[model samples]
Target: MSSSEVHLRSTIGGVSVEGQLHTLSVWFILALRLMMGLAFLQAGLSKLLGGEFNAAGYLANQPASNGSPLADLFVAMSEMPLFMEFVNVAVPWGQLCIGLGLLVGCLTRLAAFWGAFMMVLFYFGNWDVAHGYINGDFAYMLVFLSVAAFGAGRILGLDATIEQYDVGGQPLVERYPWTRYLLG
Candidate 1:
């Protein structure tokens, strides 16, 4: 109810959810975006520059020790030479692209979606339930999802400008509503 707080309410599947956010909450949201961006960027760069980032041994071995349910699937993937080749390239490159997209706030939702997806696989792959089912991977997954849902890109990000770009005399988002899924 305070002037410095913003109220938010939504109804999903007939369930109403509501909350209040302090005006300064946007800064925290931006911080999450930047932090994840840096983490992923550094990871990708290290993998690409390491020149010995073979995933086969890790994929075939790590999951089993951790008792991951997908351990068998990972092992199978490692066995397939072609798939392993693709994985070697995709993992590092995907992280780099996702990092850049999030850092610059360009195609942020797309980046965040992929980031969340990668986290999902990592959550299963790492499969550490030592203290509990919750872990860093699971937390990162939520962070990615929250970034997408909050449209964090529009806050001091290129997405704000990209959305307002003129297209046939109309803002890009207004012209093509579907772009909302990718841009913000």
Candidate 2:
């Protein structure tokens, strides 16, 4: 790390960059959020609408490799038909909510966090067990964290609107001080 890095001021699409990477990062966050959000939304909706959707089959079909580290998860989840059924219903809905939230910039941080959690679960249960080479999940996780870290919701998002919302004739923050944590 040297203090030699110098950012020459530049402009793109008529917007000033001020030699700061933050300007570029804003666009990247939006793109990444949409990518992750839409993927989850479509996947969730497909499962719910597809009459033949079943988690058991998917879980049970995991190829056994190196003692099958994911076998326990598959077995435990499959054994309980009732729980499986619950999961079948819950997972899709959760995905849909997370996708919509991230897509709309509503509760963006929470949505990103949940999306990261789901990615983590899939990474462990699927890629780790299969010894897969694809590392898209890692990329997705990083993007989610980045968006959350930068408070992206305030940029062209409902979070900005929600933050200024008035409750009982007072701004949300003034009415409920604790809402500062939840608004954006």
- Candidate 1, residues 1-184: lDDT per residue as tens digits? 9999999999999999999999899999999998898889998999999896788998899999899999999899999999999989988999999898889999999999999999999998899898999999999999999999999899888999999999999999999999999988
Q: Stretches of candidate 1 above 4 Å error?
A: none
Worst 10 residues of 2 by lDDT: 60-69
The best candidate in terms of TM-score: 1
CA lDDT of each prediction against the hidden true structure: 0.93, 0.72
Q: Write the per-residue lDDT of candidate 2 for residues 62-108, one digit (tens) a residue.
A: 62332446767776787789988887876798889888887788888
Provide C-alpha RMSD values for all models, in order: 1.0, 7.9
True lDDT of residue 103, candidate 1:
92
Residue 63's lDDT in candidate 2: 21
